[model samples]
Target: MKDLLLVLPRLARMIGSLLGDREVPLSAKVALGAVALYLASPIDLIPDFIPFVGYLDDLLLAAIVVDGLLNYVDRSLLLKYWPGGAASLDTAAAVARRLAGWVPSPIKARIFGGRRHTA
Candidate 1:
């Protein structure tokens, strides 16, 4: 419970950072923002007074958002901004690549999606 509260922000940041890019659809961006704010709030669907089950709803919500958004969000952006999570992301990508190499196409499409460059 205490641990969940502490890590919630980091999880939200990772989701936001991963989804924060021009290529990301407006709807997805909005949804991600909403979820982030919801997670950061003191109140929740399962009230904190409930003890063990209090945080379940939040965890479920985050999981759903993360799972749904993972396909749409540009993961490279996540790796760049959230360096600690980057290693795990890289490892996952590597495993995915190795296991699914037979399938075609590149997955590095948004390596720079979150950046704002000057001309």
Candidate 2:
């Protein structure tokens, strides 16, 4: 719980940094916008009516989006934007990849930034 608490702020900062970066690809920006829109709108792939599973769609989509966003984002850029240790960021990235492991590489490639960020 404590560790989870530590992640959110840094995560927000890193995401903000990524969004502001001119080098980040347009596709990633678009995808992030789409996700935000989807989450804000009342429409869900799985309606939010079911008991425990109602939010599964949101969770799954979030994971996929995170994966798409993180996978192509230059590691160096991530490190630069990160407020915490590299190991923590790497762990978070690994968790993201594992959560979206079933997604195909080809499709993932199409979803996010392609250009590597230069230090």
Candidate 3:
């Protein structure tokens, strides 16, 4: 958990970098922005004040977005903007994928806009 927390800033930086990159699909950009806004918004599927499950909804949503990015975004481009070791991002992506595994691949594809750049 501490390690995950430590990587949050790096993840934020990577997301910001990707957002500025023109190659990212419009769908991905919209999904990313919407998820970020949802995360920051006071309203949530589950309130954050609860003990253990308080953040479950946020975590699930983030995992879904991360899964979409990993599936549709270019691996090389993602690495380029990542602020940490590739292994770290790979591990995090893997974890997100697992957390979001229940979601269908078609949904993930739609979220990332089917890799519009296609490379």
Candidate 4:
């Protein structure tokens, strides 16, 4: 608990930086906007002042947004700015695979290059 408390400021700064960065994908920007709005709201889906479980909703929502945004962004772009975000690309790929489900090989190839898969 103490450890998390110590790290919360740093995490907030990172999220702020990501939100302010112009190079982040449109989807990422949108997700960040949602997060910002949620944080600013006086009423939340689950209030943070409660016990440990109070944060679960926020954590899960953040995860889903980050995962979805990452799917639309190139790994290189995230790597260039948020170094840790690069590592999350694999998780994003898995999420994309789950969400997009078997993109046509030809369309995938066309979008990504000569030969490639969406995930």
Best by TM-score: 3
> What lDDT does model 2 reach?
0.71
Q: Candidate 3, residue 38: CA error in Å? A: 0.4
Residues 14-40, candidate 1: write the lDDT tens digits: 655656556655655666777678978
Clashes of 2: 0
TM-score of each: 0.52, 0.79, 0.87, 0.52
* lDDT tens digits by residue: candidate 2, 1-119: 36545765787687778888887777777877787788788998788888768877775566677777666666777788899888988766666677677777766666664443343
The residue pairs in collision within model 4 are: none
Per TM-score, what order, best first?
A: 3, 2, 4, 1
User: For model 1, what is the alpha-carbon lDDT of residue 58?
Assistant: 67
Q: Which candidate would rank higher by TM-score, 2 or 4?
A: 2
Off by over 4 Å in 2: 1-6, 113-119
lDDT over C-alpha atoms for residue 101 of model 1: 38
lDDT per residue (tens digit) for residues 5-102 in model 4? 44345445555666676665445666668766886777778888889867766765554444444444555554454434544445444543443433
Could you give candidate 3's per-residue lDDT for residues 5-83 as a string of tens digits?
7777888899999999998777888999999999999998888999879999899889899878877788888898998
